[model samples]
Target: MNKDSLNTDYLWFLIIKSLIMKNVDLIFNEKQESTLFGYVMKETENKDKIWFWVTIAMTFFIMLLFALPTIIIDPYFHYHEPLTDYGYTFYRQRYSNDGIVRHFDYDAYIVGTSMTENFKASEASEIFGYNFIKVPYSGGYYKELDHLIKRSFSSDNDIKMVIRCLDYTLLARDKDAEHEEKDTLHPQFKAPEYMVNANPFDDIKYVLNKTILFNETYSTYLNIRNEVPTTNFDSYSNWCSAFTFGRETVLGEYTHTDDVQPEKEFTQDDYEMIKGNVEQNVIATINEHPDTTFYLFFSPYSICYWDTAHSNGTVKWNIEAERTAIELLLECPNAKLYSFTNDFDLTCNLDNYKDQVHYGEWVNSDILVRMKNGENMLTKENYKEYLDEIEEFYSNYDYSTFAVGNEEQ
Candidate 1:
């Protein structure tokens, strides 16, 4: 037990003692020494002592019972690899990605937000000839994704390639901006510090957490006891099948308004924010690992998104920020940048998207094939042309007349 547990036990003992001896006044003690009152007092005090010990014992037993699974099973694999006899699941990417990156055997990893979740490890392994792991942090910021990559490189294994998607919509935000809590009302879903850092002292939260203990640790143990199969690595975080994909489904979720959108000019602060985002989160990692090839691609958002940006008057600066990131990334010899913005047929069709930005699973597979074939690659010579073409196509497109027929689903 730690100091906190000891102090709690001591305080509990004192409270129990005080409650048991409250009536044993010193004024009558001398006269009632041999009386029935003294006998009752002695018996009552002895019983209280027994009860206190029992309470303390029960407290420790319960604490041990609650915390033992988290330590032994370790669903997150925080300390070590999964035990050979036990089955493990690879869901909960935010909680388990750190442990997976540190302990898993892989030479390459795909890192990004939910946009990269559908990319299969098996497909990458076949295409790249290196053991691949897909670690996606849905609704993640650049800092945490970069931290995960650094951890992977710092591990005992040698990382050869990093395939990641750079979401164009996230280009203009502050470098330190985190949507971990602001995205939802509940904040308990944020990443744990104990798992993120190497400090063992702060692990108390993780060890004693009800969510990790029950939802993860005990669930895994139950799965093993019941002889249930572990989750497949390829389909671990693939959520494409859970929802329908079509033009109606996509545009239904797409909210367009004629109300005046927030139109703020991109200031010097905006420039610095995006520059720091690219320099610190994206470029710094590439510069450090020249031997490891970084396959960076911009996730293709639907043209409706581009039109909304234009209506909001952010299309110009948004393009500038993404363009700036592309220029900076291309400067690194280890980095290979790809863009799908010029694929007007894909972006213009709402039937290809389940939402305004998220594409179907086929798109994920298609992206891999395209990258492997060197199609639509952004070189120093052609990147300018790609940018100008996308700018013109997006800025001049008539979104109202765009067809929404069932084409790609």
Candidate 2:
């Protein structure tokens, strides 16, 4: 592929005929091969020159064979859309998410951390009157999600709405440095840069990758022959089927600590940090694409989670930060803000969740209906009252019953 070197196709011809020329009686019957062999061997006497051309020819041919499958199958959807007739497995989130974002067909998408994995794309699409895809990063940061969304807009898809969750705890993090692109919960997996950016020089990381070769390319071949399982693109990353939801299950996952985590109130500095985080990562995208409506919600962490934060002294701090975030979002005419973080029926009931933050598929279904029906939506007028109501609910909720030894807790 390097333009500076000898042209590869020309060399292959020289290579085969020159080998046969060693015994001339070994000819494989071809005018083309004979013609090319004459062009390279013509007026050439040095033995070293012929071998040099043969080696270069073999190198390029081997390289081409190794890279061809990745280019055609494109396991990551890096180069093209999934061949419509090809079946694929969509289990690896970090590896396939970028390709889905760029090449998958959709007018709307759900983007968030693990808190969002239960959302059913088909249900959301039906309610919103748009095709929806889910792009969830279990422990994703604002900067990373924003980068992926920006790529969506850069593509030719006519995006309609962007549904994203505003994680309350993340509102207080450092404006620019609090991301875990590599140091995530699953540190072994991280989205590679060659696929994320437009650079082609580093594309060797993708074109010759082993995962793409054995797992993706070979797996696709198996699918075509009905020898392997395939996934529906719509239900790609939904994990609601993997866990049961109930008070016992939710509490079983939590380990009660007596450390009496020190409490800190939200300060002016914290508000500034929240502002900087959104303005740069979220609002900038909203401002850039006014035609694309943004459905922004503060994901509801269960009451047990709030109680833990309350004991640690940061419940009110998170509430105020979320309120500030809502205020900023409401100013964007195309943005709709929902404050589900305080929905008592959902947040107070541990049966709706698998853990402190992740809710059941039914809860995700309920949220979609609420968003469709405009319930829990914050207006410039009622956000103050609604936020206060949630603050009091979470800040004072009883969490003793959620202690360890509780079933599924």
Candidate 3:
């Protein structure tokens, strides 16, 4: 065909297709209008009474079939056990309980990743004469820690003490793009939407579906219910087991499986930065509530993993961190290091660790004992001893055979 003739034909085809699409839309609209008119006429003839009742019945049926099951079944299938537990409480409160609002008057808080979850607030309260709450959210790093400290310490509730079981990697300041991309991933870590300073739009998905999606709302309720009940020390250990193994089986998600070894000491500048944060943020937080007495700790791990970290140059960082942490406490005049790591015999047990770093609730009970006996209650002699042990641990296990601020042999 000639080029001019082919161009004309294509133009004609485009015009024809546009007209056909318009005609099809017009026909569909007309059919919809006719169907609506018929329904309206029928309803008018019946005085609209029958139609109203039928509509109500259908609506109720749909809610019962769809909404109820979404509130109940979907979370179980999704392996959101925590969500299920919260939903269960919410339903019970909404339907059955007297509907009392849960209030916060906590005197103590247990803060950390899953490693800290086993410590029961009640036990801490009983031991320390302070009411305790576990703000246990796994994957919470230093940024989250800063937020929680600011929010909780500043609240009306007089927080008497903060027992922090910090993960060692929290010192890593390499920020990921996910920190901005996935804000909705951790609501507990973020400031509340209603707060003027916090941008609610940051967690758009949570505000939308977490609030509007009625099914997911039920899961939140279950999470609240699960939190109220205090599991025994043994139950806490079993829960750790579930967290370690059951999570993989149920959700096919890994938690705290990463192996880390500290290989190099942070420079004096880095050491100062970390120390400054712990002092300004962590220690200053306790000081905000004059009534509160802080006891800081580093949780115990297996000797093998501990040794590996020590060999990897973790010992120097750990010592510097702890030393700075102590200096910050000294500034407080009332604060102390409840030194579980300083006194424990890590060489005795491989059974202590569930993995590279975390362990079960057995340590929680031991901690309670240590706190009670004042074994962890720091003295100058004991403080010197703790520093000595760090050096000894490094000398014995450190593979690089290097010292902080010293050249390799």
Name the candidate that leads on TM-score: 2
* lDDT accuracy of residue 79 in candidate 1: 76
| Model 1 bad stretches (over 4 Å) | 1-65, 182-189, 257-266, 402-409
Worst 10 residues of 1 by lDDT: 400-409
Each prediction's whole-model lDDT (CA): 0.78, 0.76, 0.50
Off by over 4 Å in 2: 1-43, 178-189, 227-230, 257-262, 404-409
Q: What TM-score do all the candidates reach, one by one?
A: 0.80, 0.85, 0.58
Candidate 2: tens digits of C-alpha lDDT, residues 288-387 = 9999999888888888788778778787777778877888888899998887775677787887888888887787788889988999899989999998
Q: How many backbone clashes does candidate 2 have?
A: 10
Per lDDT, the best of the predicted structures is 1
Q: Is candidate 2 or candidate 3 better by lDDT?
A: 2
Flag the better candidate by TM-score, 2 or 3: 2
What tens digits encode model 3's per-residue C-alpha lDDT throughout 244-299?
42212312222222244546765777666777666555666666666666666666
How much is 49 displaced in model 3, in angstroms?
A: 32
